[model samples]
Target: MSHPHPELSSPPPLGKGALRVVALGGLGEIGRNMTVFEYGGRLLIVDCGVLFPEEEQPGVDLILPDFDHIRDRLDDIEAIVLTHGHEDHIGGVPFLLRERPDIPLVGSKLTLALITAKLGEHRIKPETVLVEEGQRQDFGPFDLEFFSVNHSIPDALAVGIRTPGGSVLHTGDFKMDQLPLDGRLTDLAGFSRFGDEGVDLLLSDSTNAEQPGFVVSERDLNEDIEKVFRTADKRIVVACFASHVHRVQQVIDAASQHGRKIAFVGRSMVRNMNIARDLGYLSIPGDTIIDVKQLDKMRPNEAVLICTGSQGEPMSALSRMASRDHQIRIEEGDTILLASSLIPGNENSVNRVINGLTRWGANIVHKGNALVHVSGHASAGELLYILNMVRPRNFMPVHGEWRHMRAHAELAKKTGVSDDRIVIAEDGVVVDVYKNRAKIVGAVQAGYVYVDGSSVGDVTDAALKDRRILGEEGFISVVLAVDSNTGKILGEPEIHTRGAGLKPDAFDDVIDKLQDALDKAASDGVNDPHQLRQLVRRNAGRWVNETYRRRPMIIPVLVEV
Candidate 1:
């Protein structure tokens, strides 16, 4: 397996008739999936998405793929081909479209609809092309074909791209669920056809490569969901992904079977389900769906609520309810069903939400306790099967962490692919494919572009560090008045501390030390206000760190008179 090295320099210009591929995101992590394909000086993008913020990314709303790689080349782009409607697959469309609103979007009907609705909120009316399974379209030098792939959401697809240099098949997040709720199966025959035609490179989803055996079919969860409905005594609150149309269908069926009225919660949940319903992807029984306001009129046992926040996002509806911040209160007998698998790095937040709901006397049912959730990615067995089916000359694992990609590379090798043909790379790593060979030539800047509230790409690592310090170690501010001419302290410094485990009076000893340090700096001929502020900061920071063993954010305000 080829690994990216820090010493790797910017790749030389693309060789004649060569295809250059660079993953801006979704290489080492589970989300923010964006891949740029360059052929004949034009670009083809696949899956512009976003990554949900983890706990360490304080105050971050979303993490976007750094567009610096393509910001200058946006005009060379043909279109963005979406694979599915999941947030991790299409959530970044609006942001990317903001860069160039005229860029076309290509996807299945349902996928296009979901993104279109989302873009509507951003007031972006994008140009979209709807293509179904087995359809082929040419965008510049890339001839693309779509194939049906069953996932937790309906209308998922895998794409095949044909260029003069080579042909590539990208299996966007999919599983070989023989019995999908929508009756759509992964196109093994299509993969075999590509294998027959000689696939030069294969970029496959590696999210479940570490897990053994095929993923459980979506149909297998019917009995488990039915059991939850059969036993629950009060309102059933099901939390899942807003874009999970099939899972929502299952929840709707279960609620209908139990004669309970269902209401969608969360803005995203309501909007996506409405789109799925209107597009005929999600099936709803007659009079089964009710307004959220009507939820109050129904009996406790006669209502079902489907909301977002299965991942325990702080602002999600379920999270708000768990924290007693939402209008819908959790009763003693309510059944809170977390109907989704936990994304990695979300275990702590999910557990906190679970504990909060449990404290409210609500019965909690999650994947840990029940068979209510299954992954949508293909596992080891299915990956091996696809590897054998495609028989590509080169294999690159995408959409997973290092361990998962490494495990997938082993699977590719097991299928007789040469070790030299397997390239395991992280985000920003650039690979060039020519004459049936793929090599990691270099890398680009593919760092996280944080979204905090209305700000995009403005939150730097330094700002996040300061936020973390303020949250963890607390903050301290020192106010002092000094004479400009003599650089002499005119008054005693006033100190204040928050979350530093010290009262304002506790900083008295440090104030004098700070004044003395300022006097020394002034005597040393450092009369600059900025220099004096640094002196006070250093003195107070040293004193606090030494005395309280804490390094809080020290703000020194030096006023010149």
Candidate 2:
């Protein structure tokens, strides 16, 4: 029961000044959780994270917070402090290290280890310092104290910073699970201690602010999952978040309890679990772990498989398994367990995968059907409890959508925090705190940076818009060749269409109209290559829309021979 006892070792001479806070991301969103804190001339960043791309972000691999403001003030940054190792909280480490590799990164041991592995992919070896709960360290202009917090991942932390203006507490993603699988509870006592010290401003995770009542404990899943393993006559495959070490540990324990050997699927699950086991965060007996390739040798009832892709990501091991494209095929009577929550906006994909599994005659079990998963965020009751415990003069809710933040703000008012004391923020909004007084000041560039196949921020909204158009309406390309010496038409306009849902015969009328328009335009002295290209595009686009009621992308090419 090592709780957070963040006591400053050496205190610098204090200067009562304004503390600036910036929500670079995570406000009004679910991912990309980054926040900037500045006092005097030095700055300290709490988290550098990323978000998974949604359906609208086609061809994008990851979405990151816009670091334009930080890029301009890199010299002022003192350190990067991390709360946990979940992707949304630590996914952007490599991207940030690529820009400023010299900045020191501090976090719990497992948190730093996870990011270190990520930085290795980019050939970056950053300066990393491992700090745990009860440890207090000083970074220029800031005194940081770390405390243990219960999350789905092991060794998650919350931070308290002593600034010139006052003490600021940041509760990174957490839940008050009295019976956590790891036996480490959310340090409510530590928060109360900080409250007694007169916290100036508090920034708490609002991810589950709208969720009512208490969340189910991680320990509660053990019995139900073990029952599945005990009664299953065939193989059992479980899908969960790759970073959920606690859940993975429970799955392993269940397998061992049922006399079943375990196999790890999905690249991320294998890698992250290995890291956890090597770091002593996970305990797996060598005899119980088997390779996926060896599954054929084991009896169906003697094995358990754990994989990623609980969200139904197409490339994940579970999704591929559902499609019968993976090494292990789903057989009749097999039990497929999804030990994760369905992320918002991912219902269709998850349902599709589940339907595919069901069609194969495998029994599908998920949180929707049973008590398999619990959120790692504080629900409304827990949020109110924290608000009452850590009675900070100012409050800012982070790490959720606008609705969640607003709900949490209203809850704060219920706990006696004044309306002026709670600042509702979106991405890029800056709030300044001076002597326990907080107010909205200004803003900075806090937009999305789309990552597409080795390119960062190269994809624009306009490009995505065109992609959506092409996906919906397809595209049409027209080529016209004219004599170079004389301004005369050369031949019939060559037209090509793809994915437009129209056959050549169906496009004949449009093509005839385009040819006639081209002849008329050339006769009207519109023979300039640029003008000819524009004329073809305009006429072709107009005819397609007026006739077919579809506006596909039209590409016009004018070749002067």
Candidate 3:
């Protein structure tokens, strides 16, 4: 395992004129995988993406990388390079386009197809350049080469970027699949070719660094899906990731084998399936695909429904059906298959949906129950293989949590990479690689920008904390009217509470005590609105905490007429 180098023990202060690398996101965390490569005042961005919300981020729909660092240097941005079409890798492209339009996007045919569809939804028309494997392009001071890589999604690539300072090879979310569904294997020879030339810095994916051994192939998972189709008696409903085109293809093949028509039940699933089929990445038999509305037209045993919400997202089509809120409800003896990996931190929510479905007598079949899902990331052994192949002078792990990144660094060391050659970084930490030396240099403003509804970067930490408090303890509002001339209380104080863990009748005695306190304060000539509000909040809050053992948000209102 690689340890921190003694000479590079601490992050150095920013120096003038060096090759700078900044991770806007996808370091020390998962999702929102973005990085900025700077050379000679020119910027090249790789993978502007978004992160899904956790339980802590209440009311947040999505999270994006803060664009403050690049907002002023928009003109210097040469192009945006996309490695794949996953939401975490391409979801934020529209947001970036909103900031600076006319920047050309470069990626594989299918990757650009998915991104173009996404941009159309946001009413954006971007200049797109489609490239295949072995293609090379020059943008300003940067020269980029694309190579094929096998992942859960089709047309995924690993990028090789050449700049004046050094060269970086970014393995964008890949696994070594020996037998991929499309018979297209990862370009091992291409990775070796880059290795022969000597890479300066390698920013690799660390998503599955902690997992042991190599990942199972998508071909293995396809056979399992076929087995389930042969055994199932009734209609089959599968919940999977919408962007995983390979898994979707397997499901379509399985459905056709069982002589069933397929119906996509989610917005993303429907849209992506159409895009994949149109681009030749997905194959469907003639009239094998049908609309959701036509599901009733076919017999129960002749239909297969592939939807989203394997993670138990509330708004997903599977969740709606599980909760009996969708047009089609789960029936007795129906088979519900979850053909997706259970992402960390989503176990409880996924289990809740499973419980709901089982209560309606549906049989639950998931990755735990069957060999239906395989990860799209390289495991420890595969990471070691890549490290040995690339043999980069300096290494920085990306696209995983801190633990994953650290584990990847350890794997690199096992492959003969020295501690001094490994550079583990957090989000926004800048690492400068020169012709001979590389070290972490200073930091930048790389924070999460929350997206709620139509608003982006508007939700703050304080607001989310307040929402959590309200959810846990509730709130109280105290309304009082003051006499304008007499400086006296007009009437008894009105106390209203909601979700404060207290009933209306229970607050009667508390309200009486508060009214008396208000009258006493008024008699003492405390007619100032601010003073009265403070008095009410302090006394009412203290009394409530003492009596109920819980502190609710106390809001005091003073009105004079």
Candidate 4:
């Protein structure tokens, strides 16, 4: 029940025979998941991922977990265990690898394949150890075991760590879907075995902890998808996460049943599907998927286009089509299905895309209008079941917002876990488990490291604030010529504005005031060009704020002749 405070000091040296856990990201937010486990001076990392940019983070490509905590200690790392292949779990691997390229990567076959493909783009040949649901490996002081878990994507795993300090089980984003499309059920029996062996610490997913009941099975969406295929008289377009193999399988099945050809749009969609198919995780019928270029050759009713942008990313294929900027135009009578749940911060963007598509006379179906999507995380009931089953000495809820984590902590209390035994921590908070108990020790630097185009960690908050001001308020520039020796005004100052919501003649009112201010500063012996520039900025800014009530960015340029 401890929360982070501004006065929390840096954690003390790791106690002898103790395991210290720190989450660099994915505690208070839903994305950029990473956790560092320290034992006997060695580090084991789990799930390095990235977060998508929100509306306020303009021009940001991605957000990464701050690696400063381990930047200098990279050589002490044993390995990085990837629990799944989702972007929020594995997206930051390549960036981390750039610091230390030889760290062994451990994950399932499909997960490894996805990351390998991604790393290939970075021109990095990684050293990886391929594992599966039932396997065990030892890395320095950490002994790892893997268990099968059902999720939106195939080959998801939950990891178990055994150390001299204690035994910890991390359920990396799982749900109890009894009738999963891939025939893989969450290993409840395996969890019971871990309980029998005594689980000192249990970290579970909390993304859906607020929901009241079990999550609807992925199989349940088949009937609704079939209905969409049967009723659509024109072309059908389905948008989902590029990594959702099961959803794509459902779309492929429905399209095949209705005798329609399918095409994969978006580069990520094509690449991920190709990897899944090659690894035997995705099954596509012969000639079922054709190139996107051939989409126009078939009749309207005979084609199904599956693409990305279920969350309405600006550059995604579905968003481009909605804006009429792509090759596939949204014509009348077109049926579009958004097959993925919306991420928390993407609601406005998704709504904008939906409005754009609706304006073109296309019918839209989504989680709100129809049961076209189901959550990939377990709900309250399933969490209660796991809490009762594992019966661990300490519990930590990961992979959710604060409210979701708080709700999950309450569920743990109801299942006989004491309030003191539950640790509700945010990103960068450090928790140490020893002698079968866990407590908060201190905190670390876990701020957002923005990724702009071809740049990482270079964009600062002050820069973003200036960009916001320019975008929202506007910009104004003032140029003046000055006499260096006499410290007198040479001529009238020139002013111009952009995006300031003012007319050209608006500068005429401020020019005289600026000249007078410059002359007064010069008479007072302020001959420095920098000082003159500051005077001009102050004078012009005051006039604008007083006259127009707008706080636009004002730049002053002074020339000394």
CA shift of 246, model 2, Å? 0.8
**What residue pairs are clashing in model 4?**
none
Of 1 and 3, the candidate ranking higher by TM-score = 1
User: Whole-model Cα lDDT per candidate?
Assistant: 0.91, 0.87, 0.87, 0.92
Off by over 4 Å in 2: 1-16
- TM-score, candidate 3, is 0.95
The number of clashing residue pairs in each candidate reads 0, 0, 1, 0
**Where does candidate 1 stray beyond 4 Å?**
1-5
Q: How well does each candidate superpose onto the true structure, as a TM-score?
A: 0.98, 0.95, 0.95, 0.98
* CA RMSD, predictions in order: 1.8, 5.8, 3.3, 1.9
* Per-residue alpha-carbon lDDT of candidate 2 for residues 1-561, written as tens digits (9 for 90 to 100): 011113312223224588888878898889999998988878899888998888877888999988887797788899999999988889988898788889899898899888888888889998998998888899998999888999889999999999878789999999999988778888899999989999999899898888899888888888888888888999999999988898888888888888899999987888889999999999997899998999999999998999988999989998998899988899999999999887788999999999989888899888878888899898999999999999989999999988899999998999888988889877777778876788776666688898999999999988988888888899999877889898787878888899887777776787788788878886787877777778888888888888789999998877778
**lDDT for each residue of candidate 4 in 1-561, tens digit (9 for 90 to 100):** 123468789999999999999999999899999999999999999999999988777889999999999999999999999999999999999999999999999999999999999999999999999998888889999999899999999999999999999999999999999999989999999998988899999999999999999999999999999999999999999999999999999999999999999999999899999999999988889979898889878899999999999998999999999999999999999999999998998999999999999999999999997888999999999999999989999999999999999999999999999999999999899999999999999998899888998899999988888888899989998877767777566889878889989898888878878767776776787877777777777888899999999999998876777
Model 3 agreement with the true structure over 381-411: per-residue lDDT tens digits = 9888898888888888999998999999999
Which stretches of candidate 3 lie above 4 Å from their native place?
1-17, 484-488, 516-525
lDDT of 4 at 447: 90
